[model samples]
Target: MHPTDSRSLAGNVAQLEAGRQITVAREDGFEALKALLPPPSRRALVLIDPSYEIKSDYAKVTACLRDCLQRFATGTYAVWYPVIPRPEAHDLPRRLKTLANQSGKPWLHATLAIGQAPDRTTPGEPAPRPGLLASGMFVFNPPHTLKAALAPALVQMEAILGRGRGQGHQLEAGG
Candidate 1:
């Protein structure tokens, strides 16, 4: 799992009870991830944290996803980015939509958000500023039962992240 924040990664490790066999990549460099996995692990779940703010870097991500899809059963990709006021962020989901629409295999995507943006300053040492608050996922060849599992998990994740900032929607290929 690739996470931008140490706090979030630590929380996930504890909540998921990831075993001792797990390897934690404290740095953001993805090469470590590729090297850790075998040449053809087949399927995987990829999480891209808010670190991918530069759209140009998406080329590497897109290529990696394509290669994984061709060689694996399915690829689950989770992308997290702040809801910035620009087309770049919005365009990302659109491009992913185009990929799913053109692909023959089963696919799914979803967008999640917390509450509205929060003011920069507040009383009592200031509340944690609500981030632009957006996340998205693309699942290739997703299992039919994914909705049931993903929905509840997301709800719980939102709660742990904070309050009043829970919202999400899913898109499926050929739906």
Candidate 2:
């Protein structure tokens, strides 16, 4: 299921070819998320990939995760975030760690930095370098076999990208 706030995107999704079982909703994703939660959802994979244009999105994501866990603690949530030079982006992983600690749920934080961040000498000037410097995913209640399966894949990705200086993955288990 995909819920988008943009009407154009919603229209595009609706125009997709047949045989697609996608439930597309043109509404605020955070608000739409609650309605999608099944009462007896034993196992689920919730992917939260929001455009962090506004700082409030970070807080909303945290709140949504908290509520989702309260309703379905066994569900696995994968939050994808861009690795940018912003306070919210920098603090997301830490916030996720706090949430996992509070719930006593094991989580995994994996980051892939394709290249070094731009060298910004000026304080106010925007970082000029581009081409996806970094990206990360925080997985809550990860599968038991996830780490073993992803370890070698991450290594291969790092080798393929040719940027081993800071590109790597980390897994943290909750008690």
Candidate 3:
């Protein structure tokens, strides 16, 4: 279920002709996440995409992922994070890595930059304004071939989506 109750978002989702079911949940993401329980035999994908407008969202994301890992350790989880200048943004990757180590889970982290950053020294923090300069996806329990499969695509995306200097991509994996 999509973790949003916005009428406009629900209306937009209704327009999608996806073959499978997609429910727009009318509740908090944490509540929806807690209620979900996939069977052990089946594989599931849990994607957490936050707007990161509030500083507290960074901690919330970590907490949400920890809960999901406890409930469904085998599921593939991907977290989409913006690359901004904030210290929270800078530390999220490391925090996720620490979590992975503690959980003994394999993880993959990939980033894409489409233009020059406002501050080179602080790449993780995106500007608090419009337009995204860079973004990253941290995946827990990624497939063995996921990195190989994505390397070329990341380069292609950099070329196609890049706007100015500092346009590039980085991919790293660890357990």
Candidate 4:
């Protein structure tokens, strides 16, 4: 996991336990990912979960993913992004799919919304839901079994986690 903030990455009043191996890097993750991209023939899974707190992170995520595909088009890149009311959030999935298409790769995109985006009455009105109500993951060059496997799981997640009328899950894929 590429955590942007050291504090969140270090947080442990509870002392987290881990089964899988982990290596901590203090530098920027995007630059690190660029340096690590293997050849197009190599098979690897890259999970990119950025905070998206900064406006530039939206642009950076796509740029970095595009750069990675250029280096390793066959690699599986799983990018997790928040689903907020912001235009950037809404546009990201579309951007990712375009990149995958350009690289001649398949992608599976899934979203899980636990809360609804509240109705806005006026243009200047602040969102009733301040934080993220939904989030999504776009997987480029996903495994053949992934879509079939995740479909049922997402349905279960929507049933279990849904809280409002618009709260649900969606899965879309393309080559």
Best model per TM-score: 3
Report every candidate's CA lDDT. Answer: 0.58, 0.78, 0.85, 0.83
Q: Write the per-residue lDDT of candidate 2 for residues 75-154, one digit (tens) a residue.
A: 88999998888999999989998999899999988887766543656888777655667888899999988878877887
Better of 2 and 4 by lDDT: 4
Off by over 4 Å in 2: 1-22, 39-41, 117-129, 163-175
Residue 46 miss distance in model 3 (angstroms): 0.7
Between which residue pairs do clashes occur in model 2? none
User: What's the residue-level lDDT of 39 in candidate 4?
Assistant: 40
Give the TM-score of each candidate. 0.59, 0.76, 0.80, 0.78
Q: What's the true lDDT of residue 86 in model 1?
A: 67
lDDT of 4 by residue, 1-175 (tens): 4454655665642255641233345678899987777844376788888778888899999999988988887788999999987899889999999888888899999999887644766888765644577899999999999999999999899888777777888999999
For candidate 3, give the lDDT. Answer: 0.85
Ordered list by TM-score, greatest first: 3, 4, 2, 1
- Model 1, TM vs. native: 0.59
Ranking by lDDT: 3, 4, 2, 1
* Predicted candidate 1 versus true structure: per-residue lDDT over 58-137, tens digit per residue: 55555555554455435565555445566676676666556655656566666566655445665778577555666677
